[model samples]
Target: MIDTEILGWRAALVGELDHRRLKAPSVKLRSAQGAADGEAIYCVDLRVRHPNADHYLTSTELHSVEHFLLEGFMRLLPAHFVSVGIMGCQTGFYLAFRNEGRAGRLCDTLEQILAAIEHAREVPYANIEQCGNYRNHSLADAQRVAREILARRADWLDAA
Candidate 1:
């Protein structure tokens, strides 16, 4: 059931997005397992660019972005849960999907979903008492990134 035409969104995003490892140019990733296949899941990191590369996000903002995707993806792919978490740089999120075989199918669905999210205005789990660190959500940044991802989809989203 492997797809020959689709490169998969995880790989495409990893190939197209501004990866930190690639950005640094000097750092190299090592393995404790001594160079294994690494993972069975599909992982994609989504990033946003500010005018200055130095411009990073606040904790709350990162929280918002994480929560937004956590909610969106969970709802979008209800058959399976989606793990959406923030990158260490606070510029993006890491999405891990256990159903690796569905990457191509998900990519097609994601393009349609992302294309429809015109202006996102809410962070999913922004509860002061319920969430570990609340009030750290930014609908503005989330919306910006959503729009950005949609616009960049033509470059990074296609499965081919």
Candidate 2:
């Protein structure tokens, strides 16, 4: 069985966002559940802003970043990766993974992904054949956001 209290504590410490203000880029573990054979499924929130912040990502920027992040995560952790998706609020992303052990290296892995995005020449899979809104993407915007997130590397693991 899963420990609800522990999960709550983890979310409060690492994922809770102050709704009244803006926040720097951060990666937080939002949830984790055990699966069969001792494996676990984890969902992480990658925030670029606080929940109530008026600012949000443009659709183009979001699409570009999503393309890069989805491709990057898959390339880096193919066996463990589940999905990468944009938040409905447009403040950040949700990254899911399935693994057998503690995901202590998730922050490092995200850093690597962001770094690759920063240097990427194009947003992966942003073609008409691969995306629903293929024309709505901006590699430059994605790189800019990646840089912003990477700049906050030291704070990615900070507790709330």
Candidate 3:
């Protein structure tokens, strides 16, 4: 990482972060000040940006995926994981895990999650009684993305 400050806040130019050259999905861990206990927190990002691809996930895919990942991780890592969310730009997911050791397990955990996504019959909580806009879930698109991720998993797994 190259620190290149611009206007005010600190920043760094992360090398090989380009979507085109990426092999597998990976997250970078960084410690920072600001938490409930005033201790450093570890942050990780599971980016899904594709190179030269301007298109993003459709609304249905996004809606379904959110519920799937949230529940999936809650089932997978239990207490060690914090949260799973989609990136605002629609490029990928954001996962916040506890510490460095979790980073090592990130790829494997995601592989399992993707496998579940591939085999799932429907989005977990897509019901009028369960969710606000529950009709917008799309299992097809979610599975498509899961296949894509699985294809690239080897590339990323090695890096992670």
Candidate 4:
């Protein structure tokens, strides 16, 4: 069973999204739980655009962004990093982490990652053997989306 206290924290985390002006490219805490090993696990939805928005990330853009994000987080936060996976809706990604309490720090690291993506010249691991659909990736589209997300960094987290 999930702890009551943890549920409250989850509520608070989800509440942060209520205050966001720009719905797209924002991070929303989806769930949090305490592990048997005494660690807190956080699952966040990295919304590329509002769920209700008319457009979504193209397959190529999503694939490229997924590659960049996975590589970037692994490089930047290996200690706390868990994994990043593309959303089925093609609107964003799901980011998981362990024992990370500071939303501000996450935001900072995300901005850095996005900045790197903005300037990235190539998508990581796009080779035939490395990726299933290697041909369906675009560095330019990924860069464009990264810039859009960076522009709304302030909306990534709620006011403390």
Candidate 5:
């Protein structure tokens, strides 16, 4: 799952962030547009479709993916990137970094992040460890939910 189409849109959003030629002391993740610092801040918006309306990805599953994605990125992405958290909307993730290098890099970074998410789905709960605030969710459920979310990404994003 992990809708390639919607993923592409997400990547484009990342690309839009990356395309900006920003200055240093950059903002990482921000809730809105405009410069806080010379550095560029990446804005993320996650919109969950039919949240609480359907029994698809339970609250536990969504939070699990949020934690897993953050933990996975922390372990995988370059240290230059900072600020990682789930959107308050409980739909997607947010990541911001001080673009010390370039802009378009966020696209590649996001690709890597997405790939890690897909790979993480393959890991068994017994093998994966908890690294986020909540620990009640399992890797299996996380993977399942990730697949569902990604598969329905268009519907999710369109719902936004």
Candidate 6:
């Protein structure tokens, strides 16, 4: 079952984002669809499927990583864009921007997100108790999700 520890992680992420300066002037979460919804936006998907696994990162972890990545993106790629958030079937976290013009900017951001995941793998997540589903997962499990997602993303790049 999905855990509450995951939610604590979400709160931490939100807190982190609140403290940072995002590159995009406008970023937000929504349930709508279309270009107007994502135009000039920097979309982030906390819920990414692994090519060969049924398991996925808990929503809390995804949201936490989104916050971590958002800080990195603002620092690394400050291109103008919008932000959109959504709840995914497996998990939910996003920052969608408008148009395909920001693809290059997004690639750079994605790279940093992957790097952060790798770096956090060995680092302890003392924030577990504060996450939405603390009892459901562990640092080890988060690391596994990171490894699996990173590998899948790499494969995606190679295939593209």
Q: Candidate 1 residues 1-160, lDDT tens each?
A: 2232253323322334334433310111110111244434455545544313786767766676667667667777766544767778765666766544354555555555554445554566678766886766677766665666566654543322
Candidate 6 global TM-score: 0.46
**lDDT, model 6:** 0.42
lDDT of 4 by residue, 1-160 (tens): 3442333233455633552343676777777677788888878778887665668889898999999988888898899999999988788998999887456667778888889986677999998999999999999998999998888887665322
Give Cα distance to truth, residue 132, candidate 2, Å. Answer: 0.8
- Model 4, position 106, has a per-residue lDDT of 71
What is the alpha-carbon lDDT for the whole of candidate 1?
0.52
Candidate 5 accuracy as TM-score:
0.51
User: For residues 36-152, what per-residue lDDT tens digits would candidate 5 score against the true structure?
Assistant: 565444454343333343334456666666666566556656575566565454544556554322333544454455445666644323233544344456667666655654554
**Candidate 3, residues 1-160: lDDT per residue as tens digits?**
2121221112331223545554334444322234566333345556655534776767777778778877887888786678777777676776676532344476677788888998899998889898999888889988987787777775553322
Q: What is the lDDT for 94 in model 3? A: 68
Global lDDT scores for all candidate models = 0.52, 0.75, 0.62, 0.77, 0.45, 0.42
The TM-score obtained by model 2 is 0.85
- Candidate 3's TM-score reads 0.72
Worst lDDT run of 10 residues, candidate 2, spans 4-13
Would you list the rank order by TM-score, best first? Answer: 2, 4, 3, 1, 5, 6
Q: Which ten residues in a row have the lowest lDDT in candidate 1?
A: 25-34
lDDT of 3: 0.62
For candidate 5, list the clashing residue pairs, or say none.
2-150, 3-150, 18-103, 26-39, 28-96, 28-97, 29-96
Q: Which stretches of model 4 miss by more than 4 angstroms?
A: 1-22, 158-160
Which one wins on lDDT? 4
The number of the candidate with the highest TM-score is 2
Model 6 alpha-carbon drift over 4 Å, by segment:
1-39, 42-47, 50-56, 84-86, 98-104, 121-142, 157-160
Per-prediction backbone clash count:
1, 0, 1, 0, 7, 30
lDDT, candidate 6, at 26: 22
